[model samples]
Target: MKRASVAVIPAAGFGTRFLPATKAVPKELLPILHRPAIEFIFDDIVGAQIPESVLITSENKSALAMHFSEAPNLESHLQSNGSEHLLEQHQNLLSNTTIKYAIQDRQLGLGHAVLQAEQLVGDRPFAVLLPDDILLGGSSFLTKMLAVSAQLKGSVLALKRVPPDMISRYGVVSASQIAANQYRIHGIVEKPSIHDAPSDLAVIGRYILPPTIFHILRSTPSGALGEIQLTDGIAKLIESEPVFGLIVEGDHYDVGTPQGMLACALTLGLEHAEMREHLLEIFRKWSQK
Candidate 1:
């Protein structure tokens, strides 16, 4: 299967982890430095040659939809101030990319949120990127997944080896290494105990999935907390076809909590060439104090 030119981002989660902050603002709109986390995902999509994106969001997430929409007033203000560069930068951010929004309405599982985009995705394969999982990169990570999926003609999941103690925090996978940094996924268990974990290779937020999985998810029963688990759907897909895991090379952060959000911002700030020295000085002073 050739890699599809569309990506789906499931951003409808309640984001209960962030509490009051998320109560009024959608978690996807939170800034990771100068850009919102969703923008990072969009950057990856555009780099991967994906021209269209469907954002699956719930109510009160219109702000997220507006972020990609034209801000004529802001553009005018910047242009009138003789800030052509700023105006162009803002316009080019989403240039040549089409963003569509779908309402999940109900708070369901990640699988359910993705299912909402079936019409938008049609019958083609598509990429799924969770905004909460920010991969610090300008490009290449998603491009790699697109390559693997195109070669395998099946699903490719981004995998990372987590500590055994932390395996329970993610969906652990049992797989046989068929190639360097690549595996034939045998099974996947969600949030398993350390003792019952299949393997340390945990699934991250990046995925290139076939349209067939949507049918499986449609009939999939709700699991824990009465939410449909995308892991469960993938596990079922594994039984019928080969699913591979790619050992992604990049820094991954779960920005669902304040601590994680701060970590992402600090890491991005430190990596900025122009801001590196200033961030280092502030870090040095804070550490000494």
Candidate 2:
């Protein structure tokens, strides 16, 4: 199967959910377990053997680009001792991949941010990985999605059956089951009301979009805020092209908020016996108070 040549990561948004902490740092650069959260996304891209990554960034977010590059003269004592493996900010740079940067001059919506990569992506199909969706255990979701896209010759979205209460938080899709854990998307409703939601199958972060999406995104309308939302564009793309969803049963965390970030970190840490015992002691002490 042919692999998507370019993997696009939209890192241009102002991470308002992590304000104050994110006031100085780009949300994409926010540290999780000592490593930049965005690196986890790159881990998947590299795992899938995609050679190129294009980060859609703003002018002020130069640090996002630098994270993949060398960190010469970095201090060893920058972070606390015994935590370098978990808390790397300026160390263990990425290698053997082409890291390209595309500047989004304006802070528009996700669709507009993705639009900045048209020149870099050209006429080829591409994968989009939102930095917030950290997949644990080195998943093969991206590879599988690429394979599905190649076979179907259409766009593919990462789908997961969310609880009814949480269904309203995501772009819920009404789909017909074409195969086990796979569905042909009929339509998408962005952050719909609980009662109005079509189905629980939620479009998480990963996307395999064909080049035709660029044209659809341009003519797509602005929604919610005055920004051109990517969800809206995807909804429009559905009318013209075949869109499918793959229900991912992998460890996926939405770390856009502080609470979600903490949850993801704790989950990863507790997997190790030392950190687990340490956290257990802390929880025991807190319970006694």
Candidate whose TM-score is highest? 1
Q: Which residue pairs show backbone clashes in model 2?
A: 33-86, 34-86, 34-87, 34-88
The weakest ten consecutive residues by lDDT in model 2 span 87-96
Expressed as tens digits, the lDDT of each residue in 127-194 for candidate 2 is 99999888787466898898888888789999988898898779899999999888999999988988
Measured on C-alpha atoms, candidate 2 has an lDDT of 0.84
Candidate 1 stretches with Cα past 4 Å from truth are 87-90
Each model's TM-score? 0.95, 0.90
TM match of model 1 to true structure: 0.95
Mind giving the per-residue lDDT tens digits that candidate 1 earns over 1-289?
A: 7677789999988778887878988888887867777777777887787889999998777788777888788878878888878546445658857889899998878889989999999998899998878787546598998888878778999999999788888999999998899999999999999899988899999999989989999999997688888999999999998799999787888887788788989898888998889999988999998
* Alpha carbon lDDT of each predicted model: 0.86, 0.84
Positional deviation of residue 209's Cα in model 2 after best superposition, in angstroms: 0.5
